[model samples]
Target chain A: MLAAAVRLFNERGYDATSMFDIAESLGITKSSVYHHISGKEQLLQMAMDRALDGLFEAADEVRALDVPAPERLERLVRRSVLVLAERFEYVTVLLRVRGNTEAEQHALSRRRDFDTIVTDLVKQAQAEGGVRPDIDPATVARLILGMVNSLTEWYRPRTGGAEAIADALTRIAFEGLRTE
Target chain B: MLAAAVRLFNERGYDATSMFDIAESLGITKSSVYHHISGKEQLLQMAMDRALDGLFEAADEVRALDVPAPERLERLVRRSVLVLAERFEYVTVLLRVRGNTEAEQHALSRRRDFDTIVTDLVKQAQAEGGVRPDIDPATVARLILGMVNSLTEWYRPRTGGAEAIADALTRIAFEGLRTE
Candidate 1:
């Protein structure tokens, strides 16, 4: 039911999508939707939480790893792309949250927390001489995550799958674009 | 006036912002706004076009340069970041267009054209042995542009300025993130 709401919200703008539309797509009455979920806002929150929870869990697992800082960072990026690809609809909606409602505002705040976590990891990686130290860790974090987040916009599972995209992202991000 | 509109639209969102709010913010009458532009939608269109024009012009200038493919690609990325920072609000509004309206749909198509232009440049660079050929050129293009485009979300003119960010982006993008 949440999946149907996400698809409808993604297909039509969240503001444009209605409870009636979600119910219709799910082959249930509006009352059924109300019985199952509090409201459309609740559904949006649930979907965003689903996506954010996956990312936060991945970050935690990577942080718990005994690997070096750079390796941990790499794993986080790889895992993020994989999670995003696997939960494409959820993450897509999560990324597009513009803070119009309380739920979206919560999602935005949590997204920033996730960014700070990545930034701290980047700083650690730089200090350990794994990642480059010249650029500000925050900037590096934003750029790296930006590259990963962009997957939500253009990635299609049919094209190359998550592993292929993840490999390309890790390679391009860690290695320079130059042939040398 | 359009600058003010772009700022307001960026802050309050395009749908929420009204012509009256734009006028009130500008300390002008609503009639004065109508005298200059058709409506709020026109302001959005004008602002987006301003951004797209700058990008297209930069691409054209870079293409005309007699530099190597790698250098050409670098210049395009550098110039794009600079333009994005300089025209921050316009580009911000431009990037957020979701194609709900005719104007937005037009912006989306033109944005795709710009992406194709950059992707072709990456492909040429790869064929010329300038960029690494390991990843597909299209994927490379998307990642690079994604890194650059993320600037709109967090960049502040009072912070590093356009030149500094451009230099950092060029260095990181061309030289990779890992320290040798």
Candidate 2:
């Protein structure tokens, strides 16, 4: 049901979609939707949770690892790529969010928290001399995760090589694209 | 008028925004909007053209440069960052397009053309041994431009340092974030 609703929200812009449309798409009555879900915002919260929770879980695990910051950052990027491929619809909706509603505002706040984690990791890496220090750590964090998040836009789960894509991203991000 | 429409479209999803809303936002009558423009879509087209033309013009100039493929790629990335920052609202709208209308489909096609040019440049750089050959050229192009495009999500034109942003992006993209 959440999957069906997210698909509808992603297909038609979330604001354009409503209980009636979601119910119609699911071939159930609107009352059935109301019985299962509080409102469309609840469904949105669930969908975004599916994406954000996956990311935070991965970040938590990465944070616990007793490794250098750059290594931890690499692992986080890889895990994120897999999560994005695994929860493609949810991430799509999450990425499109623009803080128009309470649910969106909550998601945006959580997203900022996630970004701060990456920024801290960048700072740690720079402090340890594993990452370059010239660029602002916040900017570096945004660009690196920005590359990872772009996967939600074009990556197809059916194509099924999240590991390879993650590897490619980490390689280019850390090693530079120019030949050594 | 186009600026007002683009701003509204960016704030409100394009589908949810109406000509009346645009007119009201601009403190003009709906007919006044129709008189100046054919409709909302013509405005969208003009706004998108503002972004796409800037990119293609930059690409044309980069193509004429007698430099190595990697050098051309770096120049293109720098110039694209400038174009994106210069036409901030237009690029935001351009990136959000999802092919729901004739105008949007046209914009998507032009965007694909631009992507193809970047992909070809990546391939040329790989063939010239200027870029690493391990990763797919298309993926490399997407990831690199994806980093640049992410600026629209968080970049504030009011902060006013496009040159510094461009330099930071180029350094991270080409030299990467890891210290040698």
Return the top candidate by TM-score.
Answer: 2
Where in model 1 is the C-alpha error above 4 Å? A158-160
lDDT of 1 by residue, B1-180 (tens): 988998899998899899999999999999999999999999999999999999999999999999899889999999999999888889989988889999999999999999999899998998898798888888888888888888877798667578877887887788888876
Q: What DockQ does predicted model 1 obtain?
A: 0.68
Model 1, A1-180: lDDT tens per residue?
A: 988999998888788899999999988899988998888899999999999999999999999999999899989999999999888899999988888888899999999999999999999999999798988888888888888888866788566578988998888778779876
Q: How much is the lDDT of residue A86 in candidate 2? A: 91
Model 2: how far residue B171 lies from native, Å? 1.5
* Per-prediction DockQ: 0.68, 0.75
Point out the worst 10-residue segment of candidate 2 chain A by lDDT.
Answer: A171-180
Candidate 2 C-alpha lDDT tens digits along A75-172: 88788888888999999999989888888999999999999999999899889887888999898888888888998777888899888898888888
lDDT at B83 for candidate 1? 90
Runs in model 2 deviating more than 4 A are: none
